[model samples]
Target: MKRYLPLAALLVSACATEPAQDLYAIETAPIPAAVETAPMVGKGDKADDPAVWVNLANPAASLVLGTNKDAGLYVYNLAGEELQFLDVGRVNNVDLRGDLAVASNDETNSVSWFTIDSTTNTVSHIGDTPTNKDEPYGICAGLVGNTYYAMPTYKDGVAQVWAVATDAISDGPELLAEIQVGQYGQLQLEGCVFDEANGQVFVGEEEHGVWKLDLNDWTAAPVSVDTIDARNGLVADVEGMDIWAGENGEGYLVVSSQAADRFVVYDLKAPHAPRGVFTVVESLDGAIDAVTHTDGLDVNSAPLPGFPNGIVVVQDDGNPESGVDQNFKLVDWTLIQAALGLE
Candidate 1:
């Protein structure tokens, strides 16, 4: 499936606008000291992103799939126990479609498929797409009728969107559309989430900010909703994004400010603008670098009653000196709920 390429690649210049320095460091109520950490499959391996699968039949057995950038993909049980590993080599982003979990491997610039065994909390390799010249980063799964959409990060400044048969794992992914987003700073494409209800996709350029694209009409130019320069108290390097569906079935978009170790939650109701909800600090060691470079996030309604409806999980690009302990964090949504007070 990876046959076509754009005629030319162009990089978008960094926006000249700048916001004032962030004076407020995130301060919040103490997190649960008893919170358990997810077990690691190997020491020194950087775990970058995660996608969660809730097992309705066995609620307590839900699985959390994570990427080990230098290794592959690892599956863990709800209790944070590493259950299995699928070695695809340097996977950076992961998403799910039915029982299959798809991952983008940066090293090989390809996407690999894996089948999830919920009953046993395991992952088995299915197949992979043809390789590309651009390193693949963030991914989002969208379904249009029977076709599944696999969106890859920009290579040479163009993001390619592919359409694949949901059940045909071994067959290569067919290219459906290609969108060229000029490069911005060191930011390549890193985060993406589909607004299925609206048939739109949000792509994040690390340094430039986020762009909204319509799936139905690929020829229409993308609309830029927000940029790093507009966000206060955070760095320009934005990485991961997740949409939180509210009680009314509407939602908000939560994005990571990688360099500042914080998050900017945007209200999707009205003009679809950003409102700084709250900042998440590195609670483990209270070091700035500990939580810096936050990437990949997933939100799931808490199964337990009275707890906030959702929980936000983030990856910690740990300080280089803290060898053998790279990790991801599970942030309680209750505090964020209190801060936003959204009904």
Candidate 2:
């Protein structure tokens, strides 16, 4: 039931001075969202990033965790209905591996931990541990072998890796190493994703582009996978990133072209060639508005009710309603693959 749109032949070339639209070419037709979550309470530039939690037992019962930078975290169901909202104070970027959900807590200047209870369809706050970086901006977590590492990135272009012991959430998220991710005159850094299959992490330096860091050797210099270039479909201020997991490290790395209101896909393997560029337009039925000025996004390949091939959830900075606050939109992943001609 995947819908394949006609591909456009006009690819974006290098440009010295042009409008934002000309900076990144839209390679495919506009993709619409299948679901949109309830708007957050805190108005104006509050809703930031989102993380999806899959339910193996019941796919329809999966949950989406979103951050309200002015408030806390909001959990919603597959239908985009709010199930619960936790006012944990300025919880920014969020990510999850297995059942452990973690977020960068700006209020406490630490990394907050939460345990996912699938049976009850809820995320319970366990505790938080202080981070070396003050007021961590973005975070992504994953298990390297058997140990869980939570990486909290800062506004000063620095990132720190902390190992968390799940059995003892309150014990310690021992600080392992500190990394200076600033390169290419990067003063601000946020939005990151863990590539567990490759034993590496991708960090977004807002004004520059994405950098690939080796988790094994923290001292190894970061490699530039791609940068803010019009030819590669990236505009300045690159934001949220997530992986569409595939077999044996075969997949696509989706990064938010924040300034262009589009998402750019690159080959998940070495070289990281550009695959395609797309934007989420208003729903066909006009129920949900287009996603613009997105901050953070998460993609899951697990089959869900309407999203048989899984879905990508992104923060919608602008809601169409007169007074409704910002929210997140859900797009079927199969539509993206077909539109982008991805395998």
Candidate 3:
């Protein structure tokens, strides 16, 4: 049976500790954007989040899965070519693992799913899961042992973490945990990613900050991963979050400092420890322009072509090259590491 628990009330019942009051705001840096894909198919604010699927057998031939939101998912090669498009109908905030890609669809008020054939690199729509949330927004995929989880958050802050048995065989998302979170500023929130390494999930609370909540402990209160304070370097509309975890619990929590037009990095071991913030600037080669007004982003430590170490992609809301619609920008993660002295 599925369970729905209100986090605000659970905090009182469970006797959870208060989130840390002290936050670190360090210096910021600039990480240059290498290349950006062509703008999204339509006009204002179309290109959204990105998910990188590495070809385990052929890392160099990896694919970048992005959401058009207005239409469906777009499969692009490393070079930013449109290999395929699935008109799944307004599936926003996409994510994938192995052969499956899942998203939050406010259009259908459900969670949509898609599959990709690794050999042929083609995509097929499987369908969407039943949703009870009023307006589905940010969505992410996670795993515990071998079981899959589909976590979709409502624009009003209701988050449903579903244990998905609906892969190649099933279609329903069995509710594992349904909880509430904070939604500030215009009843909005976007971008969520799971940290399978530490068994934690991070949710971006647009106006407030990022929150770190344990996956198994339903009663525990959500801790503040980081917050936006203009006195510090961070600005409002804190968007797009991703985790880059390597072996032995060594990694970083990256958040898009949208209002300030930069991305901030934090130590995963000590999540609140501010490492440095960075902006994806224009390429010196004039190949791409700076990244601004980023919404959702993705990062992976697995080595792939061009990016010998890893890669990260951010939604570039800017129209570089004088384009009309927004597109995603691919950056070398190592460059960001080196720029922020994370190496």
Q: In lDDT terms, which candidate is top?
A: 2
TM-score of each: 0.82, 0.91, 0.87
> Whose TM-score is greatest here?
2
TM-score, cand. 3 vs. native: 0.87
TM-score of 1: 0.82
Model 1 is weakest, by summed lDDT over 10 consecutive residues, at: 1-10
C-alpha lDDT values of all predictions: 0.67, 0.85, 0.77
Model 1 off-target regions past 4 Å?
1-36, 39-45, 232-234, 247-249, 281-290, 302-308, 319-324
Question: With candidate 2 superimposed using the best TM-score fit, by how many Å does residue 179's alpha carbon deviate from the native?
Answer: 0.7
Candidate 3 wrongly placed segments (more than 4 Å): 1-27, 166-171, 183-187, 230-232, 321-323
Residues 1-343, candidate 2: write the lDDT tens digits.
Answer: 1122123412222232542334544454579988999887555788899999998898888999999988899999988999998888899999999889899999999999888998998888888887755899999998865688899998888989899666666677788888889776655788898898987899998888899999788899999899886457677678999999998988889999887788889998888999988889888899889888789999998888888787999988889642258999999999998988889
Worst 10 residues of 2 by lDDT: 1-10
Clashes of each: 3, 0, 0
Q: How many Å off is the CA of 42 in candidate 3?
A: 4.3
Candidate 1 residue lDDT tens string, 1-343: 0111122311111222553233234432233211224645356647778887767676667777888888888876655567777878988888876677778877777877787776776678877785554677778776777778888775354667888787674676887777876456764777887776666778887778888888788777877867766644335566788777665547788887776556777775545765554555545555323344567776666463223466676776654233346666666677676676654
Which has the higher TM-score value, candidate number 1 or candidate number 2? Answer: 2
